[model samples]
Target: MESCLPILLHSLCFVSLVLQISYASDSISAGQNITDGQTIVSAGGNFQLGFFSPGNSKNRYVGIWYKISAGTVVWIANQENPLNDSSGVLKLTPQGVLTLLNHTDGIVWFSNVSRSTQNPLAQLLDSVNFVVREANDNDLDDAIWQSFDHPCNSLLAGMKFGIDRAKGLDRYLTSWKSVDDPSPGDFTYKLDSSGYPQLILRNGSVVQFRSGPWNGLRFSGFPQLKPNPVYSFGFVFNQNEIYYYFNILNSSVRQMLVLNDNGISQRLTWVDRTHDWRLYASGPTDECDTYALCGGNGNCNMASSPKCVCLTGFVPKYPSDWESMDWLNGCVRRMELNCQGGDKFLKFTNVKLPDTRLSWFNKSMNLQECKQTCLRNCSCTAYSNLDISGRGSGCLLWFGELMDIRQFDENGQDIYVRMAASEVGKILAFSRQSHSEDLELPLFDIITIVNATNNFSDNNKLGEGGFGAVYKGVLENGQEIAVKRLSENSRQGPVEFKNEVVYIAKLQHRNLVKILGCCIEQDEKMLIYEFLPNRSLDCLIFNQEEGVSLDWPKRFTIINGVASGLLYLHRDSRLRIIHRDLKAENILLDMEMNAKISDFGLARSFGGNESEGSTKRVVGTFGYMSPEYAINGLYSVKSDVFSFGVLVLEIVSGKRNRGFTHPDNRLSLLGHAWTLSRDQKFMELVDPSIASTLNPLEVLRSIHVALLCVQNDPHDRPEMLSVVMMLNGESTLPHPKQPGFFSEDSVSEASSSSGGKHQKIRPTR
Candidate 1:
């Protein structure tokens, strides 16, 4: 009986041990201790908390790391005080405090909570946050203390990298002293919340990089920080807190931002396929990323040689130094300011708003009030919107010389710089004289535009484009006009705005839209043009109900008018212009359905002897783009010819060139047209609405000309002059070859190799 009792006791003890192992939790209660070599894994098993030695160091430190990627430590508890031997013990006190104790019960590190609580517990969360709170509290916000509030060199997902205004707690990232050492290094990345909140990286007290102020979408300096499939990010600025955070969209994906010992901040993502961490992006990406690289009153453009240039209304302070590529002295104002009421502000677009370190801000001021406030202050050098969310609100004014300004290819903000009225007038006069061969364009005031368009009411909106929205406006004299208002979020800059004004204003033809004037006031940019009662060709041709109104005759007339406009632009206009973005949306129609070419923002003007030009940045619609231009960035008059060809086909078929598919095969509109023409089934290609009213000969002739224009080789396409003559039955049509971008496979391959879809490629216009 005694032997049987001993066996029964042993069995009960073994059962108790199994139950404890099965129910092991990632939490420690009061008076409990987790010694070295023991780990507490989160409930989801995503993170583990234990003592570890970083890199090659044998010294032990309490930390938390991803459970899957065992060696990747995210948070360190005893970073400054490393233990020589493996005698570390992590414990939770009865006062809701978490502390790390040494071998002799000596306190090595502890969490300083504002208040003590009963029934305390320490938990290692899946977010890699080590938290201490009341045992019954499940809410993370109710935690007494969290490791995320005191991050190490790595900023993990769900961590707030910002400031708590109410608590005066600033959470920032400091680099590690070395790969083997977790102590603070020389570089620190923090959010400067003084004027307009922006992220700045500093090496000690010296500024190394400035991540331009957060515009509605992202930091102006980080144009590449766009929405992606992997993660979502945003910035928050309010009375209580100001911070930036990012969260991964997919739970399987792991991403973190690490400020390396070398002072480079890198965004790295774990690549499962590669079995390693891949660099997603890095700060200080180029020479222009250097803080104040262009110095005061200077602009840096990475695409340009020497990278630095003086801002408009300013000249090199030291010409010799600037010429030698040593632009440390920057530039000085060309004309001294008199601080009179007659002073005007010159607006610079597509640029990183200058440093806000020495700036003032108002959160409730509109753009007009901001300009007025700046104009009233003699010391104000520049002014811009403090917050660009929604319709744009608030104001930021810079008093001293603007610094650290750089040019971005896209996604930039606008700044209004104070300039003498005389200087502004002189600059306008110089611009006018330079293009005096064309008609002089008038600049309208903001008030006039506002009253004309009823404050840009939604009901007055005509349409929207990649650049901005268009509104219907009427002058006091009863002159109806179409107002093209540039949106604050638009990537189009003053360069394209001025280009359209200069080119379209000078172009005179019954088939070309007339530009009446332009308006540049405060932060607004708009162009006024003669209103076409029938709207754009897309609103009609693409609509089944609208297409019924345009019979064969009207459609033929519309095609002929567009060809004439293109011919004039290619040869007859004062400037030999190439309408790179010729499309259905850019074609306006009058009351009589007469087509007029519009939106010349992407047009390029060539010298008399220059036949072609190449650009690193290709700009145009994908479906209308010429194969040579879209693939190699080589553009010429023939590029317009190809776009005209696509427009002609769309008008005939009532379908967009892009996204057009056939049941027979996966061919683009151009390819489908070519196949139909080759089979002599031209009548089948015409729109069903106009099928009954079709003039067979004219339809066949138009399709043939379009096919010739879309030929793979640019040399095979006819010039606009020849195209006009052919459409008028004045010239013989040649047999067309295979068209460019015809196969779906080729399109897919091109899109994949380019790292984006065809529709995602933005038109510079």
Candidate 2:
């Protein structure tokens, strides 16, 4: 029995050895060497370490790649020292170092470890990190050396891309020379740890692109990089290190960010269905994304025809070059800033805060303090909030010219640029001007308005709103004007009145109501606008007797015109404005039945990438208000888009959204439109008066765009610019989720008010 037991134990031991050899590990102990073709895989089989060539190249190199993917190398051990033959050998030395050796027994490359140990091992981790550490040491921070410190072209999950302040070790991704070559390329993507931490891409030493500073959530310039199903990303800036990293939400979802050979940085993800990598996102997406594309003191807007334009209060240094579209020389101030008390800052909104290469910051300063600080500094050219989180804290002041400024339709930061007080005064005066060749606005006297309207007589009354009454007035020069007089008992105060004046005075578009001038005297606030004979849009669209006059063509024109006006306010205009009170009653019709957007009293201007805002005061018609704005007091350009969507449905059906009740379902107009559209019965939602004159395809498209605009999620709602494109059939529209406030009960509760007047509620802060 004892002899049989020895034989059995010997056989069992041999079998165990064979199994171990078959499923070989991804780790090597001290003094062990792995020759070419011998590979090591991670314990979890997520990553593999081996010697290989990169894309159609014969030169061999030691690298690590995903075990599930072929040739998708994430790290290269000896990228600069590539072997000409397949004689490369990776070895873990007894001194706790990893070295790449040639067939000639010469060291080709080696890991530089600060300390040495007798017991050493090299292991490939599931995080795709290759490290050489003491055999018993499991802590990463105590490792002798790691591949994460020397990345190639790719940034893998759990890898830090930034700087180790104490060690002065810069960890960054460098592009490959070419698809076939693994040598370092001209372009490098790294974190600029100076001032506020930001990502910067450089072609050699020249900056190519800069990801604006981290703003708690993301890099201000990269608003699209939000937390998603694929991964969770974050930035850490501290005394020890400053780095950006991402973690995969699901282990199965393999992802990587690679700075490609052509200098384009792309986030790619593996898709099992396609058996290929899908591009999740890419940057330097437009012409404006080019670093310093608009140069210093200039702003770049991709939506504009001329991509580059000088900043306000500045002019091209070389006018001829600017005219020829060469903005390399940037711009110079039109008027020199006199530092004393004569310099004022011009606030710019919805913009990518300027490059912070030469900047200063204070983590605890408020906006008011920031302004005072900038005012005190003679070299300060611009100032903004250092961190835009919560009520906004910290201060950032820029010296000299602001560079790499880009305008965004949404998600931006605000910057106040120092300007000559005279320039500031000129702008203020221009905003108040009644009529001048240099300005478009006109300032009218209260006496002139009183005389034009016959001293506020009822005969000249056009309509009454939440703000006040609109009166038809005839100027002494025989020009007809509509005067919007603020009621003493109205909820809208001087702030709203001045807000309207400031916004309407600067905006000029065919579809936007023209502001002739304004009158502010002895507690009387009046806005003078060009008179429209046809009155408001609701009078024509909601009244059954007058609705028939608006044929399909006229309604379509009105819709198109309103969209154009909205597009202007949201993108093309000098200032990004949100028409909070976008409704049928606020839309005025001209003599030719052209729709003109009026009443900017509830409007808000977004500055420096300011996409949305929250306020205690929610002002807008209930039926037209987006769910976010109505329920949460959160307003954005999308809020106006939602209102526009409701208006479109109302325009097409000739029904008042406020009192709308579906015949079969107890739904509001928006709910009814969404139901019909969802069921593919769009024609049923059309108004009987214009049904015969409607183009089926056009109406369907318009309905689709409207549905997109009224989507339950604000992000699901298309931007006004996108709305315009969809209306003109210039772009494809996505299927909408449920419409906001689609339920009958919710709609009823929201629209319980009388008179169809704009609702002004002050939410408890």
Candidate 3:
């Protein structure tokens, strides 16, 4: 018996060596097989394919789990029909089919196969996809079958969670029945293709939660998926497929989206420190995420005491139901559509667009065109930009009722909803009404402003302007504010004030000034803004001592910010707004010197193809005025372009365009710039204060762009969009023509006066 024991030990040692051989081989041929004690690891040894039992369960299943983190299963093969003993075998056939067998060698689970490969092999990729393909052809597209097409509870990096329309294959995530059971559970997270591709989570056939449609940047409702250091993600909608996928940006972090047994969808990342998984983020985080919680035409806000409220121009469909906390009926319009081309759209800012099941989209349409198209169709209930990316593009219009609308604190979207003319009138008349606090806009009272500003003390005063004096104020809650006191002498009446309010409130861009609320009481009207600590652009560029700090990069940033703001106004916004008062003082600067275009009292909105308007009363500053606008009373988007050119020149030279005088030449700033550009000495035009930090190429390009902008002919001037491209591009530019207001050494009052109902405003500090 002792002699036979040594022979038995040698046999057991040989068996253990055979099992260890399986761990290093990433791929296997048709003749190869893996038993319960053996396993196959990925090429990089990141993942392993083997047989395993789930938490406290005796039943075993063939699954894929992280090789680095033991017992953390990701994908399962025989989840529904598990083996009771350790007799499971996973093998590939000559037909390129992957099969799992029981002790009797009867196949319990098998992968789907379309066609047999010439050299059949089953390989586990580092991307976590188990594929059956030709050994000579490693291209993923040529694979006959892959485990990625059938994802289970865990969605690893590079996994597509969407559909392959032509092939009729839907790739999605299904929760496990329980921690101990690997069967498909009641919850599924998948893309719904009814209208747009929005992620929807369901408990059987009933929706449990929803991720709003993709808006170019991120999911409109999934703000949690923002710029992060760990991963980069995006949604793809092409002719062949539509899907959402994320890649681990940092290879050190192993992350996966898991739909747990509890029906909760969360992003999990493996933490090496704790040797366990940590929750990165979760969806349907609050009540507002519940699908259609407030039903159609209702806007949900978790910050509000009662989470749901009817949209403007709408009322609770059933008031009693709303009172009883049963708001499923949603809202109904107080006034029906006056569809004789009388219905108008009321813009709702900072909102999550409603369900899009009954919607149509145009990828090439502008916001103005979208508004007109919605008006043309009486059935259209609302419209918004489909792609809210750079400068914004595409349009999405919803028909019938808008459902599942919610409000976001930041990065929210703006949607235009159809409304009766009378309802629109009420909104226009809101400025004259008493103080009211609303979701879209808020109103501050006279007493609050007085208290905030310490009764208009000189110490709190920021600066005085044509509009009025600017005062720095701090609210009781420690929020700093900038209050613009509209002078009684200032020509901006309630109507103009209301227009400014409506425009600024609806406008949401990084380059535009953000208005908090307003004060309209005791015959006083004031515009409240988020205080900018760095004051105005004029302070930075025109002050000799302060101007030295602004290097070429900082100056270029200001130029780009202003250009982006003007571009948004002219082309991206719902209305084409002409910022008639574009001047140095009107440009506010944050602590980082980021420029924001403000003072919209003199701004005009042009609808449809109306590019220019002639006003008998000219407004805006003298030196910044364009030739056509200052002389012929013609103001367009080009006028703003001309002003931007003047601003760029001022920033470069550290001089004011209105009073600039060169030692060598008695030329105006425009004339001096033109002379420099023609002589190929544009770099000489840069500010002496920034001589040490100037980029000659950038300085030359800026001067050339300025010359292009201040051209005498409005026809010769490039549009703001083109100006942006020219500044940011290295393409050959067209030679600039003579400037309109750059005549000789002297300035003319008549030409300056020719540029308003009330002329020239000095913006507040």
Candidate 4:
């Protein structure tokens, strides 16, 4: 009996070894399964293919799960079509395809990867991806096909999530139908690479949210995206494909990109000590993260309560509807597109960039060549750099309306918008004509603005602009000047040059910027202007420490000084011009807080008896444009009046109108002050930095006049002359009405424009 027992044990051990060998061998065929419930773990133990019921469900489904974690399913072979009984078999065909057959039903699930080879084997690699290849091909790169190309809700480390242009097959991740069901759901995550690579989360055809375009470092839309030691991101762009993939930098950290049931994506990693996954980051943090919340050609600032706004060239389509918080309609262009030979391009800087779906690209063209190409093609509406790396080369042009534009403090791309050449000429003539008025600096003997900027050092940078950057310099003469050097391959061009010269030369005022001279030689167009020691008004008004130093006396002096400056333009200047773009940043401060308006890139001119005029092309910033000017392309001194009102409120509060959060109401500073002044609580609206040190009567008077100037109806709003007179107690101010975009409730009205293709919101340039 003992001898018989030894023989039985030896036979059992040999049987176990044989089964292990069969499992690892490539000859095991599919029809030879023996059990009711079974699983085949890959030879490398990286993945397991089997049939299992999810949660407590009675129905069974064939799936691929992690071998290390049996419950962690990565791919399901039959998610939507589940078998009622456990009679399923997963088999690889000779044609390099995977097929799941059922005993009860003839066909269950199948993977169809077309291959010419007759002898094929299915294997799971260490990356947990299932692949099928020719049995004779030792080179894994020659895989006949792979399941990783078609992902479910999970994005593995090396998987490509983009379109196969040749096959028109777009590989995207669809969310699980439910928490318990692994079936596909309405939500899908697709890599939109039409213009750039941006991860868009969509519910059916509608976009639920978006991850801004992938900048050189990270996604531009997500400011929180920073360097993480756990993973590294890579973007692949070529003629055939555009894909975004990530690799685990730390082998010890197991991380996954998962689209959960509620549509939140979390990049989670396992923590050994905690014995659980730690959340690294999540998307859709704020309202602005939603796809095109504000509308086309709009900018969004999350710091502000009502985060959506139009860019400089657009206005609300339905102003009343937008004021009601229905932003789906988006905004309309204040300036009409004539598309004539007179059309020009306006450059917007430091922006996240609009959607590039209807755009064309060229890799070798410079900015000048790109502009010429776009100008020749009337269909081209805008143009920008295809790649913003290494001094920025390549060109991308947009046809039709520019949509979904947003400003980012970091990793912003430049876009040149189409406008009337006459309009552009008006802007160019200002700078160009003024430039020649002064003695021209010698061509070849010019000092690079960078050298003047101390080798273009960041520490020496005076300020930045749409054209390029400004640096304070003292050219050997010990005479200080602000050098405006054009960025390499910048959007601003000769037209902008001519505009600056023509417009600024004819105008003369103590409160206006004076052009000393210019250097236009060898790809460089540098504007040399009289350097103001105190710098821009934004440097003082928005700085906490600097703002505290601006006492009531100083604030009053600045208010009066700015008023006089506007008065000179509206009533005193020979041209009777309208500074379409009037904002805190454009107001230059001298040694004594005296204000000087600068940057006429967007300003428009008017002749005698020109109280009002219409333009097909509207150009100005948001939060300052009057309803008529922003919506109907109508402009006059009244437009400047609205801007002045906004400027006054901003200076007094030391906060930008774009991100201003109303405490008791969801209204802009102009609107909130109007409400408060109407209720005699205007003093509460003063900036805390200057509140304690301001004159109550003067501040109240200024606030009242500002409100009167920002009235919803352009006619109801006081002109710059009346506003200045009221500020100086020379005229009695009238009661103000509800300002455009003012909100009475805590729920502010969303901007009328959406971040979609058609509607765009113009910003206060």
- lDDT values of the candidates? 0.78, 0.78, 0.79, 0.65
Q: Which candidate gets the maximum lDDT versus the true structure? A: 3
Write model 1 residue lDDT over 366-447, tens digit each, in one string.
9889999999999999998877767688898999789999977445777888877644421132133245422224456687
Expressed as tens digits, the lDDT of each residue in 1-765 for candidate 2 is 000000001123322332344227879998788777677888998777777676667787888766556457778889899888878888888898888899897889999888997798888888889888878889998887888998888887898889998776799988888767878989888888666678898899998889998877678788577778989988887889999989999988888888877788888888899876777888878788888887789888764446777775677888888778898889899789887677877766667888887889888899889989999989999998988867688999999988999977455777778888755432233232133323223345577788999998999887775567888887643456788887888777877766776787667677887665666667887777767788788888888888989998899899999999999999877678898988887788887888888878788877677788998666677888898877778899999999999989888888877777776778888888888888999998888988778888889888888988888899889888888888988466688888988866777565443223347531100
Candidate 4 — which residues are off by over 4 angstroms?
1-37, 40-46, 67-70, 94-96, 116-118, 166-169, 192-199, 210-227, 337-344, 420-765
lDDT of 4 by residue, 1-765 (tens): 000000001123322432343344322232334223455556655565656656556677766655444455667777788887767776666565677777754777787665556677666665767677777775766876677777777776777777767645678777776656778877788888766567788888988776656545555555555567877777776667777777888766676677765676766665668755566667666676676777766666553224555544466667676566666667666567675566667655556666666767777888778988998987887887766656567788877766666655334566777765432322222223233222112121254445656876777687665567787775432335687777775445565565555556556566777664466656777776767787777778889898887777887887887788788878876567777878777887766667777776566666655678887665556666677766667888888888888888887877877667677556766667777787888877788877668788788888888877777788898777777778988456677888765753311222233111121121111
Q: Give the local distance difference test score of model 3.
A: 0.79
* Deviation from truth (RMSD, Å), model 4: 22.1
For each candidate, give its TM-score against the true structure: 0.60, 0.66, 0.60, 0.53
What value does the lDDT take at residue 438 in candidate 2? Answer: 30
lDDT of 4: 0.65
Instruction: Report how far off residue 523 is in candidate 4 (Å).
Output: 32
Best by TM-score: 2
Candidate 4 lDDT for residue 615: 73
Question: By summed lDDT, which 10 consecutive residues of candidate 3 come out lowest?
Answer: 1-10
Task: List the lowest-lDDT window of 10 residues for candidate 2.
Answer: 1-10
Which residue pairs clash within candidate 1?
Answer: none
Candidate 2 deviant stretches above 4 angstroms: 1-23, 425-496, 499-581, 584-599, 602-646, 650-765
